[model samples]
Target: MALAGLKVIEIAGLAPAPFAGKVLADFGADVVRVDRSTSTMNLDVLAQNKRSIALNLKSPAGIEALIRLCEKADVVIEPFRPGVMERLGLGPEVLLKRNPRLIYARMTGFGQEGHYAKMAGHDINYLAISGVLNERSKSGKGQVVDAAMINGVNYLGSFVYNMNKAGALFQTPAGTGQLDGGAHFYDTYKTKDGLFMAVGAIEVEFYKLLLKGLELDEERDKLPEQTDSSNWPKMKALFTKIFLGKTQAEWIKIFDLTDACVTPVLDYYSMPTPTPAPRLLRTPAKASASNEGSDVFLEVGGHSKDILAEAGFSEVEIRDLVAKKAVAGAGLEKSSL
Candidate 1:
């Protein structure tokens, strides 16, 4: 009901924009999926709660119709290549100038510039370009690498490959090893509130501390051997029962001061923001000392004069650039760049 009056114009695409429109639709927004006249994309799950329309963008009549619709809409979700909307005379700058309050969300992969900007891309292309495909590469030299989606996912389990050489130890059935989630201490348990708590007290000291935090240290002598694979099921049952007795927040408070390596399994948006990982030994990043905030969201050519001047352009050159429409947004202002 939060978005009851919101109207969203979704230019149909393969995945991203449709999913977003679906979410908006779910929240009571009026989402109209504008499919191309020739599109064969069915009313799939993403189109569940929305309406659809076919429009031939190439036609002047269709373009005018869409522009008129956008003039009355709140948001336009466009996921085409960078300049496609501008080429069709429906760019954010043009639309925003007409409606003034409309939200234009330009979605793209590999950004608006670079080699892949104009290329048709999918999930694999995204994974490969983002360095995710080589997360475990040891080679320092550049080399050609190729993989299908399935092969790329299978390679991520390479961590368990070394155990394959351990003879009898490797003979342990899959999903029955400690790190494979066979041990109670290295698994997730449901809490009273239906959320989950991840307990990974792998080390003996941490495990002991975990027991102390959970108030289970008194029964530590009665508990089965922590590393005995044969006793894993009973241990798992015991931990599961105990974990559900308290909410995740309660357990967090209990274990916050202990070295238990315990944490809640939070949903995507609810997860806490982690600090940036890389740190310099001497000049490591820290909270800014200044209280000043600098947030400047500029229009397309808002900083044209400033950018040219910073690049060593004279005041006369900046004026000429603006006069010639080579630069934009600055209209004969007294404060020259």
Candidate 2:
């Protein structure tokens, strides 16, 4: 719990926004979600271990109340159209001025400043612009795989990963700014069984060992360019041959010891526990959203009765919110995985 003592304020929204808050809170930060006053407490698995304060952000008084929370918060998370928060008078400019050390996190489909900044888009559109989608496709077959994986994986890594690294960028011991960290050389390599291995980094030793493990002619040279004409056929043939001779477990054993970076490709569920090197561990929690339930990492808070009280939930308000879908708990069941 490196972040055990930090305090965060989450301006409730969908998907990645809530996700970011959860990651921080799970890592032992005090995350208070400012839920929509009329929002039902649909507790998704990712939201486990976090508390909620139901409030109407549209109300000026409500917005002001959140600003006050921001003044005491080390970080704030909001995902809205670029200036929507600004219009609500809760933008970074206003809040950041009040607390200069505050980490004002804004999550959006596009970035805060760009031609598409103001345009409406979702995860697919964002990946499309970043060259991620095109690269994910093979030979332009027009098939759409789990693009949500790209969105969730990349965005989660970006926000949570950067949140951990944000302390590095400031001039003083502590200051605040934004960071956009995305995936680099993490992807799949072709296999002999017509399967592919999703490898990462492709480091020098890995390149050498891959050449060695495949038993390629030592004198044969590797092509540097990644274009179709340069990469397919020959490389695919070799990979197919190398992997065709062995099961995935066999290959994992051979490569696991070397710096030869390699991993067997798997769908989300098929991935093994204690996965390859540089493994990350986070608290386990179940969350549900839009009728879909899955386990997710949670960033949590210190228990406080007053914090819950400040949420202003009357017995009637609580019952009504639940009845009308205004509040939710971590309404998730255990996933088999």
What is the number of backbone collisions in each predicted candidate, taken in the order shown? Answer: 0, 24
Model 1: per-residue lDDT, tens digit, 1-337?
Answer: 5567777888877567776776676566777776664444353346645666555577665565567667777778887877898999888777877776676766676567777777877777776665322321254222212222333444664555555555524466767877767888899999999999999998999998888877776365587767888999888898899999999999888887678989889897786543322444553333222222322111222333443443355788656544443333324344544
Ten consecutive residues with minimal summed lDDT in candidate 1? Answer: 291-300
Best by lDDT: 1
Off by over 4 Å in 2: 41-45, 93-102, 127-195, 199-208, 219-232, 272-305, 308-337
Instruction: Please give the CA lDDT of all the candidate structures.
Output: 0.65, 0.56
What is the model-wide C-alpha lDDT for candidate 1?
A: 0.65
Residues 73-104, candidate 2: write the lDDT tens digits. Answer: 77777877677988889876788777766777
Q: What TM-score goes with each of the models?
A: 0.43, 0.56
Question: Could you tell me the TM-score of candidate 2?
Answer: 0.56
Q: State in Å the error of residue 157, model 2.
A: 14
Q: How accurate is candidate 2 locally (lDDT)?
A: 0.56
